[model samples]
Target chain A: MALGGDARVGEVVESSSTGFVSQSYRLYGAPHLGALVRTGGPCPAYGVVHEVATRGIDPSRRPTARGEGEASEEDVYRSNPQLEHLLRTDFRAVIVGHASEGGTLYHLPPSPPPIYAFVHVCVADELSAFSASTDCLRLLAGSGIAALEEVVAAFLRHAVAAQPDPQAFLAGAGRQLAALIPGDFRTVESILLRAAP
Target chain B: MTYRESSGRYLGVVVGGSMTRGVDVRLSPDCPVEEMALGQHVVIQGQSRRFYGVITDIALEWSDDSIRANPPDTSNPLIAGVVATSAAYAMLRVLPMLAIEGEFAMLDGPAPARTVPPHFAPVRLASEEDVQVVFGAEDSRHFWVGNPLDMETRVCLDLEEFVTRSNGVFGKSGTGKSFLTRILLAGILQKSAAVNLVFDMESEYGWMGTSEGTGMVKGIKQLFPSRVGVFSLDEDHSRRRGVSPDYLLRVGYNQIEPGDIDLLRENLGLSEVAADAAYSLARHYGQERWVRSFLDVSGPEMRELAADLNVNERALSTLHNRLSRFRRYDFMTERESDESVEEILRYLDRGIHVVLEFGRHRHDLSAYMLVANLLTRRIHERYVRRKEEAMGDASREPRPLVITIEEAHRFLSREVASQTTFGNIAREMRKYNVTLLVVDQRPSGIDEEVMSQLGTKLVCLLDNERDVDAVTAGTYGARELRSVLSRLDSKQQSLVFGHSVPIPVVLRVRDYGTAESYRELGFLEASEMRRQMERDADDLFGGRD
Candidate 1:
């Protein structure tokens, strides 16, 4: 993909996803992106704004892989000039976490030019944790956009976790999901994917 | 000559007087003198004449009645009681002579004692000149009646004083009290332009106050409003227990004093808590916009409301029903927040005495106190709202209203006494330019504090010794009042006293030719209900067959 380059030492654009996260948290429920990452798959992930880091991985440095995913020597690094292009844009990413015998490890993938069906689990997990408490429920109900966002994030986490995935950590974690958030799983999936990282 | 040795000493007599026929010789030594009784008569020659009539002026020896009683036998023992007992005995006199008579002649010892002569002069009815001395021209205008009016002059039970501040009439039953009251009331209403409000219990004044051929042709309810301003206390008009609903509760009750509260409890058989609760509920209801709807509430419902507020349920309900009935009277419409005195002025000017007549009603203390209180309040409200006559209405043109309560003792009873608002107003209304004309057979039934507040006193002939005593003692000194009340004849005769008249004068009150006298005469041999029936018959038949 053609990436626009700029100063390599510039500060990363801090995404306002936290504002979105709080809004969406009020609007919907907890952030679903975190759960989506921990239980990886082409799951729908949603969060409002966690922090955004735009200084891309140095291309010259050696890459390291941790957790259950196979360690590979792939050149997944991008230059600072390319990072500028992504920094100026929305910070959308597929967050994946691998847990195994050694310990739990986290992986964040490069943002899709247009979001794809990658592991969108990290945002989903965080959204789930925030929506669990009653105070949060009340906050979500009264917080307007924040309430809607909280609800949306919670739904996304539940949706992604419900997906059939052989490698999903929470596979068969509970009873079969009767319905997804917004009362329509397919519609929610399409909307999440359309707005995905 | 045989009378010389008699133990009876020589008593001086009229000598050489022009009226004296002759003088006689005396037997004993000169005797000490004593005063003579006024108007006592002595005889000389054959005719009897008063001592003063016998002698114009002279020094005469006299003795006590005790001495005369034990006169020594000078004539024959059988004639000891005889010999004409000297034909003239000087008697003691306490009072001075008002008029001059003939002259005295010097006579011998043992003059005969004096006797009162019955002068056969024809009795003269009281004349206006006799009343004028006590009642000046301005007040004499209000005086009515004739005959022996002079009797009223001395005691000064001055009723004119009662008329000024206005007076009250009170008494026990059948004292000719009401009859006596009508005489003065009819006089005042006819002769003066002063307005009167008669609370005619038993529909007593309706016949007279009505504007038919009944003579009050200029009465307001006829001339101006033509409404049924007069209300009846008939069962149809008054509320019965459990049968009638309370209007006060419906419209809202005002603040009640503690004495009134006690009366409500005692009279209405309410507990203290209940009375208090009912009172509070009434006050609350008064402030609410939906107050009138409360009238439609059942008695039990009302009682419950009062009970809820801890009011004497019975009292709250009963009183509420009673107040409700008044609203039905044409004169009483729903009061607007802005109803002005200017509106009521028209009615007053129409010469129709607005009788806020609460006759035969079961108001007890609450109704009397409340009504009186409301009137005073209304008057004050008007006075305060008045624009100070624009610096020209200086005559103060006092919104002349006279409140005539027939049985004032009921309202100003010693039972409620100083605790009642009526008592308060009775004392205060004078300053507010309000006059109270209280009428009752028993003035003693009323509190002395209230009775003393009256500026005018129209004393009709009262027969009840206690009633008379109380009224006379309350205002006038007991001595003179006792004399006047004792001698006062009830047949149209009353002593008008107080500031309203120049002096206390008793005269037969002038007849207004109202049906009152007829009612008084015809009221005999009839039950109250029968009397009412007769009145109704008379009204319908117009006195024709």
Candidate 2:
């Protein structure tokens, strides 16, 4: 069962086609070619819904040439059992994206499909999930974006410590890495609030 | 790193690929190395988790317990397999620090490799303080310095080492026994101003010319003159013409008793007795020339006069024969004179170390007797002079002269005791500081008393057990001394025991680097001989033509 639109935990839904399956778990975002692999099934099936309107909404904002070129085939390979284990576990969320500023992607050994990455976001409040996930996703892209958030959050909390601005610090570093590939940001608001200084 | 103390010893953790860091364990001595079975890897220690180190000392260790406990009935696969496995690993590892890790790291880095430290440090047996105390403050007597087995030992000997008394060097031929002997001699010559007289019968020391050419020849020849003195036994006849009749009689004849005079009379002819009576009468008349003047007369006429007196011709002839040398001396002494003889005697009295080089001459007993007689006489005169001076309440400086006789066993016989005057001189000369450096291949052949009196002895590599035992018998420190002598390799090891050197040291002599000099000398002599041969050949052919 799957949901076509965004979701709230309490909402109940049904799949377009189902036979004794669990309640529809709604998950949709930009770059709409997303996937949902049912891990525990006898013959686990991986469904990739390549939405026809995805390219039209964000065609110009594709991943950089380097990101598309140097990416490993493992990024596309999905492991259902591993995904099922993480999804059914106590872990709030798992992110299989760029780990630090240099843009090295981190995939757990039981990887999920490439289209919808695993982003782990453990936030106190669910309302701020979207903003926090976006910031955390950006952080996974580069040192510059992550460092900037650290500075902004530090100021907001009146934790204005004697430290340089992160973006300026990254610029001062001179060298740059290729841009990061995009990932789902459903829990960004909560991630951003939790990661605030 | 975590460490634990076990059996009162600390054991360190095994970090990375290294051995236990803080362990202090060594191989136990109780277990004999020979008993270790093959193919058995004994666990020495476990440093970290899952990291174990083992040592397989032998192959038999890997055999089945039952098979190992019982003797093998036959050559079986079970034993063979274990032996093969054990051979693969037998290295002992202590710690990473002790391992060759540092050397390998240095090799991997950017630099050339060199040497590792030696297991033993070179040191001499004696020290400088010992040297100062034993040899006195006078630096001249430090003969053992630079005389040890190596350069480091030389430095130590030079700075240290002491000798309380004189020393001796003995060895077999070509075993560097002579070379080491020379080293001690050379060292003495360098350190002390004390006089040394070397009797180089083999002509070895004569080559101590200048260290100009190269190799062993690299020495200061200015130590003495190149051509010191040469006494050819072959030329003794011509030499005798210059000595006085009294000296000739002393060497050629021994004193006779009155009983021999009666025997001489009985053997003489009546006519010979008459001739001797007339000659005696002329000598009584103070006509020394007239005694021999009758020899110009006819033999028959002289016999007629002798017949009238009833003198025996042969007995008279013997007296005339005896008087002939006196007449010959009278004629010869008038021209050459005895002043030079007196002068030589005086010069000898002043104590000059003279070399009597009898070059390439086969032994001549007469020449030996003459030279020996002269030397003995001079020495005796000096001894008397010293005795007289002491008795007369006069004081004089002591003269300690050592006479070295190379190949001495040739002249001084062990079987001949003090029979000859020379033999007696050899026996008694020790008291007058007249020490004899008796060198020979056969030390056993020399007079035992002479050998025994020589307080210092240097024994080089001896091929003959008898010779080694004989030389060793007279030495102190017999255990180390005996071992050193028996173990000496030909031309390498030398056993030096004496008052000159402290204890007996087996030394490997350094080459004097005089090979080039010797080669040059050899080459020049060979070319000269060749040229002379060619000239002789040409001369012979031209004369035939």
The numbered model that scores best in DockQ is 2
Provide the lowest-lDDT 10-residue window in model 2 chain B.
B48-57
What digit string (tens of lDDT, one per residue) describes model 1 on residues B1-545? 12111121224332322112212212112232232211112222223322212111223332223334554334432122212222223332111111112222212212222332232211111233322322333343434333333233322233333444646554345434455555444444544435555555533443434221234412222222232144333434433311121111111232223344444345455555544544465466653322354556774577567656665566666655644554553433344432323334444555455544444443444454445445544554454344244334636545455666655675677866575545655776544445677777778888887777766565665667777777766543344444555555545555554555433444455433444543332222246657787889999988766
How big is the RMSD of model 2? Answer: 26.8
Q: In angstroms, give how far residue B376 of model 2 lies from its true place.
A: 3.7
Candidate 2 per-residue C-alpha lDDT over B506-544 given as tens digits, one digit per residue, 9 for 90 to 100: 455544545442332222245666787788998988744
Worst 10 residues of 1 chain B by lDDT: B242-251
Docking tier of model 2: it is: incorrect
TM-score of 2: 0.37
Alpha-carbon local distance difference test for all models: 0.39, 0.35
